[model samples]
Target: MAPGSMGTVFIGDPTAKLPDDLLVEVISRVPYKSTCCCKCVSTRWRDLISHPDHRDKLPRSTLAGFFHATSATEHHRHLSHGYLSVSGNWCRHDAALSFLPKYESLEILDCCNGLLLCRGRKSTDPKTLDYVVCNPATEKWVTVPATKWSWDMSSACLGFDPAVSSHFYVFELVPALAWNPIKRDDYSIEAVGIYSSKVGVWTHPIVLDDPIEILYLSGGAFLSGVLYLCSDNNSVAAIDLEGNCRIIPLPTPHDDPGGPNVYVSRGQLYLTIQGASELSFWVLEDSSSENCWTLKLNISYLRLFGIDYSSSEQFYGVISAHPEHNMIFITKGFRLWY
Candidate 1:
């Protein structure tokens, strides 16, 4: 009405009476950062912003960047974040995770569905560790309760599925206790403890029947309702909600005997092995069989980046692999490259 309009008189606030579905649709189209900010506008906005229905309608959160550790001082270690682009390059930026408490050192235990499961130890006692789950996009985090079990030889991973449930879970892997050392292996019983966000507590540890040794470098990937873990013997172990366990051996043999990085991408499981000059990727074709592993891609540094594969330059470990985008994030020294 104020501008050049032909007999068009705008009524009261248009958004005031807008339908919740329409508002949610508009808000879902915006960036996640903007949607987070809108949560403070009103109670309705807050509810819609975080509601599972609204979040499900939004786009899937893909791999954006990662937080990399640089160096450690007397007290705290320095961390930097890097963003990945479609051009296969990572740009560094400063990320002050204010949600994280002050600690001597912090380790990224796992990253899944836009959340980071971090473990940190205080300066007074490095043996005692605290855990935190953080969503860097919204700067929202929650401290995980201290586990009832011992931290010695324990590892954990994050499990989340936006489709099946709004809540996520944490799976902690620990070794079984031994009354007598001479009779049985140290890792004869694999204990799996789950922490659910909805219940806000850690459930009783689920003990597996088999005594499978978990590999130190074996990362976990959750698909469907089961979590897949790589064992020290280059075999994959799958555990479901019902406490059933199955061991699937890898078809392609490896000489190093080192566990490759395991991850889930686009409803499929993948494994990546880094060699001196090339990186090999294997994908699980038949989920039902759980034995077929096809070598999907082998990328050589010389061919991909025009860098000498046999160069004496320092190379960093593979940080993450984006299956949907066909990119892998690697760190070399202090810099991250894709």
Candidate 2:
């Protein structure tokens, strides 16, 4: 068989031909699309592939895509529809993110697994925000009701785990209130509100035992059930499901004016720092250990795009890293490439 191709499967007597174990190996090696097609192959294949254990054993899809800035004119606020390629190429799908209704302004807060956490606010009620979790590929979306602290939240994230449960959780981190005992100038996020899809209600705000002062908070990434928030102060806040918070310092301070991009890929935490000429990657070896960061990869601008690092005309940003692949998506101007 050709490389990366789904090898053919010959089904016959279970005892003499293809056993259940060998059938699983064949299905697991095929691409996700092929695996989906197997449902129609035979009742045995369908049942074998759809079984809970068999489904969990299958490998995850390697390709993941993200939509960058929109190309809408002043009258419209639609994001341009396209995806970045693994080879750093841009492909336009000629689609817009009109999935959410009646929201003139929409922003992508974060993406977890295959779902996107989007923040939307209509022009009429600018103060109120609406959060939605959706799969762009399946065009399936669910709107999360606003929690009491949603209006005061500094950042939000989507927590999802297909293995554990079908329902996902939406978390909002609210900064310290003015009337609290902590000084107003402290500027720390002391409260968190979590909305559980399983229960369809937002829980009361959970106060942290030790609140960390944060200058600015980027969106969060959920890794191994813990939500990690990157801040502008060269630190990260790790919050567990129980609302316990731990402050973790970065290995090196960010040189770029904008904060570094942090994400979780394949259960490992990664932080990317953009330099003048090269992009430095640091992997969190052990979240609990000191000096946990280890330098992983550095890509130079000259080699990445064949452009001079000193050039003043072009600007680039790392979009995201693939879950299991060693590829990352980046954008230059309006074009996105993996």
Candidate 3:
């Protein structure tokens, strides 16, 4: 075999090409980074590597661990963040994001699929910050341009599904004015700033005709080009890529003490509510049209952790659900469990 022009390797004859099966077998054994580099060798190579039939034989990314922030303590006034590997194989990964550009501070805002959205303060100007989206697997990143009213934004979330499209979006929710007496304390969303990676620019903040009230700006789930957020008025606010918004009422009353957690598991939207002693899981069905949540599972804390619930002491809180499995991660006191 000899190296030919345009990244082609010829065997015996200059025009002879390798078989696709053999290429797949060879590429599957190499590291994921090298496999990605192989895609740029030629158009034929790229097509073969990206083909649906060859996906199973290709080197792909997997969920290895989680990035989390610890609560601020008296000794440590600032929050500290770290990564926890699920399989106790953490040495191979660099969770510190050392590949990104130097910054005064970097805070992880959200993560979807294998991408992370972070806020990095400029080293020279600590008061100025930029939103950066990066893939730790490939060490590729892009900085999002700031919106005109970024200072008024309350919270932000990432919306990306590589299986759906190569592009990604960032949603920044702008809260209603504080002096608005009618919407006070409701946490109503007055406007939304949407940034599209495909266009490489942010659309002017879209002002909502009717403000949507949300409990908090913490948890959100993005699926099928739509973002699902927990609503304060016993419902969920579903916003699509076009900025259209709708409200889906919960199947049961929103009486959970800590509010319901919304997430995507196994390509489905799910909600988990923690009660006094039991945890109830709900799945959103027929989400394309009329949305309805169906109860999937309900289990008591005693059965899950063998611990009786106490009214004065909170036991566990659901952190997240497995994206590809039916497992749930929970935090109890200072320990994490699944």
Q: How much does each candidate deviate from the true structure in C-alpha RMSD?
A: 10.0, 9.2, 11.4
RMSD of 3: 11.4
Overall local distance difference test of candidate 2: 0.72
The candidate scoring highest on lDDT is 3
Candidate 2 clashing pairs?
Answer: none
lDDT of each: 0.69, 0.72, 0.78
Tens digits of per-residue lDDT for model 1 on 79-127? 4333344321222222556557876667777878777788777778866
In terms of lDDT, which candidate is stronger, 2 or 3? 3
**Number of clashes in every candidate structure?**
0, 0, 0
Question: Among these predicted structures, which one has the highest TM-score?
Answer: 3
Point out the higher-scoring one by TM-score: 2 or 3: 3
In candidate 3, what residue range of length 10 has the lowest lDDT sum? 86-95
Instruction: Please rank every candidate by TM-score, starting with the best.
Output: 3, 2, 1
- Ranking of candidates on lDDT, top first: 3, 2, 1
Off by over 4 Å in 2: 1-64, 68-73, 77-106, 121-129, 152-154, 176-188, 208-217, 308-310
